[model samples]
Target: MPDSVSPPRTIIVTGGAGFIGSALVRHLVAHTAHEVVTLDKLTYAGDERALAEVAAHPRHHFERVDICDGEALRAAFVRREPDAVFHLAAESHVDRSIEAPAEFVQTNIAGTATLLDVIREWIDGPYAAARSDFRLVHVSTDEVYGSLPLESETRFDEGTAYDPHSPYAASKAASDHLVRAWAHTYGLPAILTHSTNNYGPWQYPEKLIPVVVLRALAGESIPVYGEGANVRDWMHVDDHVRALVAVLERGRLGRTYDIGARGELTNLSVVRDICWLLNELVPAGSGGSYERLITFVDDRPGHDLRYATDPGRAERELGWRAEIPWDEGLRATVQWFVDHRAWSVERLRRR
Candidate 1:
């Protein structure tokens, strides 16, 4: 680890109550000196209880506002006078995007535009005179690169051309472009990071890993789309959070970095692994094992076959790399959800 500086004195983290956002908030409060202001609309995907660990901290503040609300975002920006921003708010589910692309466009695109506009104005109007070092770190996904071929050895780099396959990825691609434009056109310092699939504690159960874990624990059929050959590079949320903080502190403005574990596993393999672990940890019924619950389901519309990322730039430039091994991370994640079953059940009931 590099020498640590005193944490950011004041930072704004949009979507700070969500899975990865909450992890980042916990990290900042527990490990650093940053006074964090979490601005979240508290969408179903976001739960304030996730941040209960640091909710009582005098330095931690929460604002209930949507990024799409331009006037509200502007007011928050002015009031907070944030020295840095970690923009993580978005409509992120690919399957949900297929059902309703409009929401994805509105939140990921329009909302990002609104936030950028506010940041641009804030930089030019008030903060310009001070000329302090500031950065806006925009968190995005590797899905914007579309799919990688099953046999391909190459991984997505920061230079990979945009080839979004789903509405969600397309919306994120649009937001990525807007962030870059704000940096280039208006000189607003910004950095973008595209990370592979993240698995860890506090994940919404709708996501694949969590869904599989929960359904298997309940003895429900675990759905596998298509042949379950879709491949995803999995990064633990903690590692990704660390990379995001690194980008905010050290990355060059207007540059994009890719953060991933390079631990690729097929969907079927991942499901089976989870089942096997569950069988050992929480034995199944007398008649069957958790793996027996696997059921093939129709593939999602426009499902990307594979996604992988090369984190070389992030490693070389930011001095960051994924530390947790995949199996260890997966085990920890499964144990977390198992231990927090009530939390997951309550969240699903709310949905």
Candidate 2:
């Protein structure tokens, strides 16, 4: 809401077709004057349909290029000459990472390194004149902090130490370290943000909330891990993109910000909330609620007990706050999947 993003700037948004990335792209197109070039490899989790809203916009563009392809990355950087880059490309699922840690390391770690090096060389060689104003906003996950005690009052802050337990988290942590190293050693202008679980429309069905909504509609048993007591802090994707925009504009170089909405709940509670919401929106079975489909399964290997983060630093410094309330956002998300059930179900089937 600060009058326009002021003085239009061209930006490159990596992974712009994925859930959070698409939302950010849409937000930029609709709310700001910045010209956006979406750079995505269109992985299994990415879908161009998510960008339908902005597909024809005059300021919107798309390039099907992989970050790991260094020459292609270099070409794209030279072609776009972007003033800013929001790096959101990564292999981001914990279960998928567990099943194939190599893919995660390759995409999340190697891909990040390739992109960082391209940007570094761009700044040092061809784009040095624009270096003073260029910014690279690297979006990352809070899972990199590992787990916290379920009943504890502690929350990860900006200064929290790295303790990644899963392949996905470890890969992101490594990428974070690389970014810092580039900043320190190569004088890259960059900032990093660690955010909690993000949920909203267009998320891949494999995620918790989408899985619950999609599977319940298919009459499949909804699975929860262990007693379903594991907790997570949820942040609506819209609010997240807004935070990303704020950080791109106002964040300090070489700083890390912890982003969370403070909407903490047990896994079981999130499942139940979705079930009851479905009961109201599109009652699944004979009058009985969808909760009947809930079945607790064995917990994931090395699963963290709980995950939460304190966003005090982001709020205090950026003058940004999560606008959507948790319950309202969750309910809206359930309805969105239900409303788009055909698309959701098809995506799940293919997955």
Candidate 3:
């Protein structure tokens, strides 16, 4: 009941037009008594239509600004004076990162540094008195831990040593370090949450689950890289958004939390499941089976074999646990895409 007891004074969320970011904003506006300011540069991957539901709410405001712009970020901080910040902006595609790493470095590393510098000034200067209650939550990915061995029984915990394998993860790893340094050196109230792969509505088509679903529905070849045996721990977007709010409200500053649902599935199995669900939900396709569209392709460089998260610390310390089962959540997600085919088509066209 913290949302009822102590409403957030003002919360600023970056990358608020992206998939996970949009879901977080919708959840906050619908379920909490907090005012929200969404700052996004609306990159090609960031679609403003994802936030159509709450875009016009009185408590919700949108600002078109890039995080790397120190002046704009500083002005935003001064204008919003947010009690908490959820930093979710980053160039997050592994393949795209491999193709063009400079964008990732500039946005993920330099952009995060810019925000930290502005925050340090705000904490030491005008907002010095209100610094104690101010909290900044940096959203990161579990890919920074690299791949787990097939024989390994343990999951990636908050204490997992950094083993980033891709340009995307390396950039995020740098940002993580910057956040930690700012917290330790300047005593800024900051926390980091590294989460597992997320699957839900509003996801971009480049990701695995969405790619398969969209391709299957469109009767296009569904690409499966490297025999599709690579595994991932999936967490529904709702669960991740809940975990983020928990960290922002009750988590210890200077600490790192790993958020996940512990639902592990291989890429092939995931694609097959999505195909099965679509076959049942939408029966108009030829061959009556979506799996026929599967097409094997070369894997991306530095592709991890597996990823899983150990959320014991988050559960024990923050009293947070993922509530939805993968079966039910995945079904709901598939049905959402089926019901909103036009939206997805338009998104793909724009991309």
Candidate No. with top TM-score:
2
Alpha-carbon shift of residue 140 in model 1 (angstroms): 0.7
TM-scores for every candidate against the unseen true structure: 0.97, 0.98, 0.97
Residues 234-327, candidate 1: write the lDDT tens digits: 9999999989888877898889999999989999999999998898888876946799999999998888888989999999999899999988
lDDT of 1 at 233: 95
The segments of candidate 2 whose C-alpha lies over 4 angstroms from its true place after superposition are 1-3, 285-287
Worst 10 residues of 3 by lDDT: 1-10
Clashing pairs in 2: none
Look at candidate 1 and give me any clashing residue pairs: none
Off by over 4 Å in 3: 1-4, 284-286
Q: What's model 2's overall lDDT?
A: 0.92
Could you tell me the lDDT of residue 294 within candidate 1? 96
- Candidate 1, run of 10 with poorest lDDT: 1-10
The order by descending lDDT is 2, 1, 3
Q: Highest lDDT among the candidates is held by which one?
A: 2
The Cα error of candidate 2 at residue 191, in Å, is 0.3
Query: Global lDDT of each model?
Result: 0.90, 0.92, 0.89
- Tell me how far candidate 2 lies from the true structure as C-alpha RMSD in angstroms: 1.1
Per-prediction tally of clashes: 0, 0, 0
